[model samples]
Structures are given as C-alpha cells and as structure tokens.
Target: MSELLSVQGLTVTPANNPGKKLVNNVSFTLQSGKTTCIVGESGSGKSLTALSVMGLLATSLNRTSGSIQFQGNEITHLSNDALSRIRGKQIGMIFQEPMTSLNPVLTVGFQIGESLTVHLGLKGDALKAKIAALLEQVGIPPERANAYPDELSGGQRQRVMIAMSIACEPKMLIADEPTTALDVTVQAQILALLDELKTRMNMGMLFITHDFGVVADIADDVLVMFRGEVVEAGSVDEVLFKPQHPYTKALLDCVPDAEGKKQLKPIDYSWLEAA
Candidate 1:
C-alpha cells in the first residue's frame, strides 16, 4: 500500500496556445497493488492526464505545469532518453488499440523480447525463454510468440500487449481503455488477468475508461472528470453508490442495470449552464 506515484497540479495545453488548457490542474495518487480508475466521457482529458504522467504528450500538446513523482523521484521534466530508461523497466503502458500499437511486420515474441533485452540485457536462449514465459503468463501459448500481430485474434492481440507491458515487471502500469476494442467475454477475461497480475506483482495501476461497469469491477479508487477537471474523487463504494457530483450522477444514469429494471438515460449537461 505504499505510494507508487504522485501527480499534482497537472496541466496540458496546446503548443501554440498556452492559455487554452486541454487538461486543467488535476491531481491524484496511486499506491502499489491498487487500481485507480479515471472515469470520464470522450474528450474529458482523462487520457491527457495519463500521458502527462508518462511524459508521452504529443508534440502539438505541452505539459505546462505538473509535478509527476514516481517512487518519490520527480519525472515531470525528464529528457526523452532518461524517460526511456524508466519507461519499460519501471513503468509500462498498454495503449488502447493493440493493432496500431504493435508492429505488424515483427513477430510478437521478438517484440516482447525487445524490452527485456534493452532493459535487462537478456539475450539468446535466456531472452527467448523469458518471452515464452511472458506469453504464457498472459494466456497466450508460447508457440504463438512466433506469429505476427495480424495473425492473432483481437483478444489475443490485446493479450500480447498486456504481456509486453508486464514483461519487465514494472512497478506501475498505465492502461488507456485496454479493453475498449474487445468483446464482452474477452474484456472480462482481460480485466481479471490484469487484476490478478497487479495483485501478484503489487504494481500500481492507472486505468482510463468511460464505463462504470468496468470501474465497479476493477477500481479501488475513482476519479470522475468533467472538462479536464476532477469533479469527484473517492473510494469505489463512495463514488459509485453515493456520488456527490451531478456529473457523476448523470454519467451513472447512463449505465443500464443488470436486471433491466433501471432505465438508461443520456447525460444532460444543460444543468451546468444554469449552475
């Protein structure tokens, strides 16, 4: 339960327009072995917040202000080379779409081994063995490691992404809607696998999603974002069962109940103007 990452006063703005903040001042802390879910609709800046922490904001966007501390060390302004050293080894990220994130030409095994080779200096038989082990760990057969990303199913491709992220046994993981593109059953399986891995390795996880159902299944803490600001933050039960913010309540109203007893409603933001 130790503090693994701390982010304070994070702000992201366009390179040309410093005053136009895409992601306004936001703050949160993630502890080891815990999952913190950032729940928001599209364009609410949840992904931007995660990118700022990873130092992966696009060239068009600039992180104007923030203090990103990982394992008590400030990484807000680290150079690309310095951040590269920490990225795969200490902090790993699973992008939303596995197909685009993975290289189609390279074998999945080779791709997985790249991080292990670069970070741990593993090679030859040792590297291959580790790659096989990682594939197995993520529920993919070791033999499939030789196959290309295009050859695998969508679920399998996502599993490959997960395998690659956890291969280095990083202390923290940032997953940006990793299950968004998968089917329902596969989504559940991937979520379960991630939860199991996080607990086993005690890795702190920052999960980004718009689904409250997913949040209920995975989140230890929840942060509800609206237009680049965290409108509500609390434990899973407090936020889900006893939401304090109107935006949170509105968002929850959109989710359909399991027994079809609750009517799904679209979020209405007209109240904001009146407020």
Candidate 2:
C-alpha cells in the first residue's frame, strides 16, 4: 500500500545539447507489491526514466531537473557511494539484454553470488546455498549455475539475470524491456516468472516495454509515454479498454486483438498532434 518509488518532474537532457530534453517532466509513483509498466515506441525515454530512478544514467546524459524518492528518502542528489549502497541491495535492475549485461567469462552462480557477497556479506556454504536457491527460484536448474553466459540459451541467460537481480531480495525491480529479445513463448514464461516473484517478494516492479501484449499480461498499472511525456496513467482496464488519451487509443489500435478480429492500425502521428 505504501509507495516504494516516487519520481516527480524528472527530466533528462543530453550534455551536448541542453535544448534537447529526453525525458520531459515525467512523474509516477510505484507501490509495493504492484507492477507498473511504461509503454512506448523506441527512443521514447522509457529506458531513461528507469535509469534515472536507479541513478544509473550515463555520463553523457544529465538529469537536469526533478526529484527521485525511494523508500521515503530523496535520492536524486545522493552521492555515488550512497546510491551504490542501495543499487543492488534495495533496488534491482534487469537490463534489456542479458548477454551484454552479464559477464561472459564468469559462471552464472558466481555472478549471482556477487551481489550477496557485496551487499549481504555471505560466504562459503551460506553463499553457495543462496546461489543455488536463486537459480532454482528463477526456474534454472541448480547445476546450471556452473554454466557460463554463452553456454546457456537466451531465455536461460535472462533467468540468470533475474536470479542476479533478486539475489539480494530487493524491494523494487526495474526491468528495461527484459523480454525484448526472446520468442513469444519464452517471453510469456519470463513474464509469468517476474509476476510470480513480484507477488512472492511484495516488490514494486517498474517494467518497461514497447509491447502491449506484455503489458496486458503483467501490468497492474499502465503508464503510456510519448516523446518522454506520460500521456496516460491508470489501471490496466481503464487505459487498455477505455483509454481517454488520444495516444493511448492510437497505441491500443496498433495491437491486434486476441482473436485477430480487429484490424491492426499503425499510429498516425498527425492525428496524435491534432488531438
């Protein structure tokens, strides 16, 4: 019932071009045990928003304005050392691609144990048991913990990423298009796994995806973003079935119905501007 993360008037701009605002006054609140999905086209600043929340924005991008509060404390201005204390401990992040995010040389189990060692100071038998349990929790066999990232399939790699993210039992999880590279079936399975974990851990999940199908499957609350601005935010039913914003309606029109009865329509930018 309590808000775990609240972002207000958040704005991101490229360091070279101060006029270019990547994220424009974006704001939202994520409650514990709930999943909020940010949906939009590529370059819509959805990923930037997530990075900003974790204070993980790149050096080239500047968080010019806004406030980010996590667990009732303002973190937007926190020092790197302070944010580092919370990054993998209280807040976990699953990036878009597991291959790029994970280390190719290290075994999956070792990577999962890294967070525990750093954050919780687990070692020896205790660390081993925790890593094995995490592997099983993400549906990976405990034996596979010994496998390298390249040795596993795409889905397995992602599960490893999930295992790493939740290794510390973070209160909030930020997933940036985590299922984008997987097949439909794998995507569904990943979504189910994430949803189950969220419920079991009572974590506030900020899931970013461009796919409406994923949104329909896992989101409790939906935030529609266009050009860095949230045009609509509401319960899944309200925004998906009875969308009020023109952008929301246009986005809905683009998704084919379950039965394929409704025709899929691409967004008409001119119409969005007009509306």
Candidate 3:
C-alpha cells in the first residue's frame, strides 16, 4: 500500500524551447504491487512522463520544475551514476520496440545476462543459470537463449526483452507500450505474462499505452493524458464507464466495439504489434 514512486507538479522543457514546457504539472503516484496506466494518444507526453520518473529523459531536456521521488527519496537531482544504478536495478524499462531495445549482435542469453552482470554481479555458471530461469520465466524456451534477436519472432523477441528487464527483479517496471508489435493472441499472452510477473514480483508498474482496450484489461488505476496534462484519472470503472472529462469521453468513444462480430472481443486488441 506504500507509494513506490511519486511525481508532483512535474514540468520539463526541451532544449529548443526553454520557455515552452512539454510536460505540464503532471502528478501521479504508483503504489507497490499495483498497475498504474497512463493512456493517451500520440504526442501526449505519456512516455515522457515515464522517462522523467525513471530518470531516463534525454540530456537535451531539463526538468524545469517539480519533484520525482522514489521510495521516499528524491531522484530528480541524483547524480548520473546514482540515477543509472536505480534506473535498471530498482526500476526496469520495457520500451515500445523490442528490436530497438535489444541488442543486434548479442544472443538472447547475453542480453538477459547483461543486466544481471551489471546490477546483480552475476557471472559464469551462476549467470547462465539465472539467464535460463529468466528466459523460462518470460515464456521463452531455454534453448532460445542462445538465439539472436533477428532470428526470433516478434513475440519471442518481446519475451527476451521482458526477461532482460526483469533480470534484476526491479521494484518498478515502466512499460512503454510493451505489447506493441504482436498479434492479437500474442498480445493477450504478453499481457497475461506481465500480470503474472507483476503479481509474483509484487512490482509497481507504470504502463504507458494509447490503447484503451489494454487499460480496461490490465490497469488498476488510469490517467488519461492530453496535450501534456492528465485530463482524467480514477479507478477503471470511473474513468472508462463514467468518464468525467470531455477529452476522456472522446478517447473512450473512439474505442471500437465488436459486439456484432463474434470473433472480435471488445477487450482484445492486437497491441502486440506496434501501432
């Protein structure tokens, strides 16, 4: 029930426009063992907000105001090394594209072990054992650990990415459209995987996605972002069924209903593939 991370009055500006803020007064709290989803259309600064909390924002941008605290400790001003240590070890990231986030030359085993080596100080047989366990945990075959990224299917590649992210067993997992670029069934499988892992690891997850369908499926709490601000936020039922904001209602109204199509489930969208 404790807050894992809290962002308050957050505002950031790109180097190009010191006067113009891209993220405006955004605030949210991610509690332990719960999933807080930020749903918004493209360019709404959902990912930016996640990056800011993770201390993974690009050097070209600066936090002009507000505070980001993790486990009750302020991180917005932490040294680069301190933040990096926390970024992957205490907080893991699953980017939108697995192909881009993963290594081109390294085998799946190596990428998964990379984090263990860096954060957990694992090596040799211990590292191999851990990597295999991670692969299996994420639903990848043990044999596939030796395979390269390009040689695997989209879903398989994503599994590898997940394995790598959870290698350190971080307290928080920030997934920026993690299911993007997969088939419908694959998306469900991946979501189920995340749900299972979150429960097992007791992790606080900040899932950033444009898909309301996903929000309906997996979110514990929802924040609807628009034009650099949260337009609506509440429990899923409140935000989805009884949306209070016009923008939130508009976004929800855009969700496709497949009641007429027997094969199309309302909550089943192919977010496994990139939109």
Candidate 4:
C-alpha cells in the first residue's frame, strides 16, 4: 500500500509557554486503505496531534517543528487557502461530537451537500442524488435529510457526520474519538461502517481513541501515546497482545475482556514516571 499521509518530528507548543511542548517529536505514516489508530488516555496529546495534522489547531497552540506530507505533497506550511482547498475535499474529518460539529439551523442533507456543492460543483438533481446516497450509505434514511440535527438520535447524527465527511470522496479521513459518545452497539456499527467504507474507497484512516477494544477491532497499525510521546507502536496483534513498554502493558491491563475474565488494572503513573 502507498503511503497516504506521513508526519515526522511533529512538535506542538502552547503559545503562552513556548517552552512547554504539548506534542513532542511525533512521527507516523498512514497507508492507503489502512486504519492507523493513536490510543492514549486523555491529556496524552492524541487530539492535539490530530489537529496539527489537519492544520486545525487553536491560535494559542503552534506547530514549532516537523513536516506533514499528504499524498506526495507537503502540507506543514501551506497557506490557509491552500489547506482549505484540500481539507474537506481530499482530506475529510469526522469530529468527536457530531452535535456540536453540525449546524443546528440547516437540514442534514444541506449540510452533507455543502461540501459536494463546494468541492464537486454538484447541483439540482445531481447533488440531491449524492446526498441521498451518502445518507443511505451511512444507514440513515434519505427522508431524514430534511430533519434538524437535534431531531436525530446520537447514532443517527454520527451517521450523518460520516455522510458529510465522505461526501467528497476524500483520499484520507481523520476521525477523532468518533465513537466516544455512542453506546456499545452503535459504536460497533460505526466502527464496522468506517472499516467497510475505508476498504471500499481505498482511503487511509487516522483514528484517535482511548479504547483498546476499538483498536483491536479496526486498526491495521497501532501507535500508543504517553505524555506527548509515542511510547509504543506496532501491528495491532503485537502491540495489543505483547506490548514492550511498561506504559503499554499498563494500558492493556486496563482493558476488560469480553467475558469479563481479565481483571482491570489502573495505570500506576508514579511507577511509570519512575521507569
């Protein structure tokens, strides 16, 4: 598989405290038709890493170093306009919270069609057909396009978000804890749907999450983050079943087995720091 996205020596720092690096020397590559998951507890810089890749970081945060290459193009220093041209069209993003990411005033279809209109120049019957197909693809009824974001259930709203992200047939997708707010069944459905779509489209997927179970289900490659650094990285089976880092082992121990047979153990940060 070809490399779809690559990041090298990526570093993010708080503007107020230039000395404090929030994301330190991160590096990874995502291949076409593959899902690379970045997993860690909250405050481990997972979301910040994703934002830096998308060029969506807050003004208060800055990428002080590193290069981001996408589809054979360098994106680390592209102008905002250049980035915008590629953002939704070639690189789609599914934010953590669908309710907050979506517009409350517009109908679901309109929001989904927005990018199609902007990127593909579709209109009239063509745009409508595309929107309907996207909604259907995500398992939402085409009729629900007329409904507001608040009217839909959490799972449905997320499905709509998925529809919006894939509207342009992007080459890569960035998903930031996309299933964090859903129930177990819905989470499973969403993960399965994403995996299926990724395979069908041959799109590279960068998924951020704290759940090891989700990683086991969807990831082709796994990168474990701890305190702004990549503590461990390997194939899903290798990292999940035979972690090298103590932090990785501690994290694996925290995940409960399906039969509830494995005892859940909290990470010992004090010992982690000592090591």
lDDT of each: 0.94, 0.93, 0.88, 0.93
lDDT of 3 by residue, 25-119 (tens): 99999988899999988998998899898777898998889898899999988988998999789998898899898889999899898879999
> Lowest lDDT 10-mer window, candidate 3?
260-269
lDDT of 1: 0.94
Counted clashes in each candidate structure:
0, 0, 6, 0
State the TM-score for model 2. Answer: 0.97
| Candidate 4 Cα lDDT to native | 0.93
- Residue pairs whose backbone atoms clash in candidate 4: none
lDDT of 4 by residue, 97-125 (tens): 99999999999999999999998999999
After superposition, which runs of candidate 2 have C-alpha atoms over 4 Å from their true positions? 260-264
Residue 81 Cα positional deviation in candidate 2, in Å, after optimal superposition: 0.9
The parts of candidate 3 lying over 4 Å away from their true place are: 260-275
Per-prediction TM-score: 0.97, 0.97, 0.93, 0.97
